[model samples]
Target: MNFDRKYLVWALGYLVAGMCVGLYMAASKNHAQRVAHAHILLVGFAVSFIYGIIHRLWLDRPGKVLATTQFVLHQAAAIVMCVGLLLLYGGVLSEPVLAPVLGAASLGVLLAALLMIWLVRQSGRAEAAA
Candidate 1:
């Protein structure tokens, strides 16, 4: 299967898992439990899956080195962000430390989104030129 299709499936699976987490959180009244569920659903599954799909659909190799660099940055950001969120929610990480990690991940995701936009624009331009 193509990368895009694989990503789509991954995204859908994350969505489903997020929904289940949401339901579980709703059923529980504990604050920590609710926060943990939120972190897993929102940061761990939703954000990472969306970013992965966007990257699979949009990233192009101008050079092997650059492409590899981007992939590493993206994956690293996702992993760090997810771990930071989990730690924060579990009360193992302080806000001062977690904020920067989460911020970096947000920036990484934003960069990927921008790359997707650029790729779409480039395709449109190429089609127009043709």
Candidate 2:
């Protein structure tokens, strides 16, 4: 699909997966996936949806390089963070790799967020100047 829709699809997928995880936890009475559930719902679903909204609202902005970078970073961060958190919560990742993966994912997410903020602020300034 289009640019914004891609992120929205990812968000929706995450929401569905999160719901399944929640249901499984409820049925099995095992709370170990609590962290994974939270991350998928919040970071994956909510944050990605927000990014999609931003993309939709600012569709006409120039500087495709920045926009593309932000989009890639956001998607990558969401995927990496979700997977890393899932591995950590499931006790699959070892001590050494766990921290690094999580840290890098967190940094990627932070950078993408900051980039989005910058883009929005820049657009606001441009509109004001116009």
Candidate 3:
């Protein structure tokens, strides 16, 4: 429904996903997915949860187009990064081909961060004006 709830849900989902990865690593005794697991937990779960808190406590209009775009962009980029790392580490994909894809995904994450910066600035300006 609301943007804060959406972010919270996303965060929880990522937490489950990340924990699953961790569990698999423990079971298989193959820790090659460490990078992916870490990213999923930190970038996916922690960032999204913090975003929920920020939107709920600070943002007046968290459902704006830019905010929605930023949320989607960050999720997509994190998914891409996690999947790419999995494939790369599992030897399912070669580095030469996946490197550019991972680079683009990383760039998407940066863009999402930039979008969040803009959203925070806009929210601050709105709050000040009010």
What does the lDDT read for residue 63 in candidate 2? 67
What digit string (tens of lDDT, one per residue) describes model 2 on residues 27-87? Answer: 9998888988998899889998988887788755736889889878987887888888778
lDDT of 1 by residue, 1-130 (tens): 5434444555566567556656765677445545545655565566557655654655432234544454455556655665676678768979998898789887886675565456556656765676
Candidate 3 lDDT by residue in tens digits, 1-130 = 7778988999999999999999999999999989889988988899889888888888878547899899889989988998898899888999998999999999998898888888889999888888
Q: Which pairs clash inside model 3? A: none
lDDT of 1 at 9: 57
How do the candidates rank by TM-score, highest first? 3, 2, 1
Clashing pairs in 1: none
Error of 3 at 30 (Å): 0.8
lDDT minimum window of 10 residues, candidate 3:
55-64
Worst 10 residues of 1 by lDDT: 59-68
**lDDT of prediction 1:** 0.59
- Looking at candidate 2, the ten consecutive residues that score lowest on lDDT are 54-63
